[model samples]
Target: MTWNPSDFNNTSGLHISPKDMWIPELIIHNAVGDTYELRTSNFMKLAISSNGFINWNTGGNTETSCKVDISRYPFDTQTCHILIGKSSSLDYELMMIPAAAKINTFLYDENENGEWELLDTSVGYHAINEQMTFLKCTLILKRRPLFYILNILLPVILLSLMNVLSFKLSINCGERMSYSVALFLTFIVLLNIVADEMPKVSKTISFLQLYINTQLAIGMFITTISVFLVHSTNSKTNDDVTGAVHAVYKFCKLCSKKQQVRPESPKGDDQHEDKYIKSGQCEKLEMEHVQQTPGSANAETNQSPSIVDAVNVIDDTLFWSFLMLFVLITIVFLLLCLF
Candidate 1:
């Protein structure tokens, strides 16, 4: 086999030499159709003008196998042009053609007009465009099991576990509110991260969204319960209040008992304190009044006698009323948590 160097014309001001001439073979593999479209811009030429181009047609090619030779002349640049046809009837709308094509490079050289000989081989792929040459490959529409476990499942499980902490903290103290606020903010951060990842499309709520919303609602409930419990605890009628109520009742009863016996005496000294004075003179004066007026005696006998009895009755009633109120509140809270 012999190599030929055809004569070339140099219209531009440049010397045409033969010593630095070499040909590089460009091979196409996994061609899609009977004819593939190959543009001349893909080739690398050493000594040719940027505009100097060639269009070689690979006519009558097979679907699976095809080859072309370009070793006739020492041209600075070489490019091939061909058209490819589709053979299958399958829908190609969803198919990505550019992702399927892989390319490799092979070097060939000639020594003193001998046949072209292979030197070395290299493997690489043609990029879709210059901007896409260094693209980072990523998977689409397929959920990576490991990523789901880490990003979605793990976070949701951790958030749910945090909710259980609410039960440990006392509802009347700051622990409930503080823990709830912290968990709520955590859910907000996770929600924001999830929102950024997903496309803004209107549809059913995602699993992650449902999880976050549930956690938020639980936190809100915990906060509300904490507030209610604090209010209930603080709203108690303590011993001082009960004592004051009993004292009021006793004083009213004592005043009524004394008014029945004693005349309306405006000149009396400290009537409230004098009414409580246990003196024989007051008792004799009350007896003389009762004997003179049978109606007064009947009224005194019909009326409840002692202030201490009235105080005891009032105290018992208040104690039972507050106990029932506390019990009702506890039952309601229990029902809410159960359901």
Candidate 2:
């Protein structure tokens, strides 16, 4: 707080209220350390007439670019400083004093601001060599997590789940790759939005940054897996293909065979025998054809590119890998941030 009395005779026993007298102009100087910008405004007011004197009050809300420590991020605390002093007058010519009753008597209530809660306020004197002393007020604030949880964390988590679900799409379709790429781009855009809210300086890695980086890496990995799955469909089923691709074809054939239903035995007599004889003849002809070209049917099925036999294998592998990574990253982030 600051004030000045103009056109007042201190020698006179009569009082001179600011409302009745011309007020003096005073300017404040930057007395805090050189780490923040000076951001404040001043409002002057006249006080009630007193016994033999009058008083004037001058001060206003200040908002500066305070240095932030985001190690805890949504749970962080910050201290900001404000200084009030005469700009042109030295200590010998003019002095600053704090009101005894008002200093350090204020308590901060919770949820007063959306993102930050005022925790404490303090008053002190900062001396500059032997020429000046400035009154400084320091405010302590803590972040409120409700806003960020609703805005940032929840959306990223949903995006991560969407990325995992992308693997369920058919690798034969081009939409699989396109969908995954779109999700990856969405994650990047959300991360950029978050970056805009953070300080430009990188004194320490924030927990939010770590979470975003982990999610982005996961998205990239998912995209890479999708690309590989798409490429796997273009491979031929010849013997020149790798053992892994052959194993994938074998697995697909086994799964298909398990899904096939066996025909039931006939329950009747003479008609059944006739039908059985005809079926036996057909089976004998099929066996002769198989003998002529041993593995032709299996080879033809494996060589078909319309259906990628290896895609299911790739999709299942990627799903489990992504799940484990997601769980591990979440646990670590929780331990580091909430604990």
The estimated TM-scores of all candidates read 0.32, 0.62
Q: Please, what are the lDDT tens digits per residue for candidate 1 over residues 58-159?
A: 223334332222121111012222223222222232222333322222231234323222233223333444332221221111122445457754675566
Taking all chains together, the TM-score of candidate 1 against the true structure is 0.32
How do the residues 1-339 of candidate 2 rate in per-residue lDDT, one tens digit apiece?
Answer: 222334354323343334455543344444333432222222344553424345665544434456778876766788877666665668877777776513453444464567777777778888876897877777787888888888987888788888888878877777988899999999999889888877776897788778988899988988986786566666645424455555665665576666688565566676646644675765777668777886886576456433354566556665766777777887787688788
**Top-scoring candidate (lDDT):** 2
Off by over 4 Å in 2: 1-54, 61-63, 92-95, 100-112, 202-205, 237-311
Q: Residue pairs in steric clash, candidate 2?
A: none
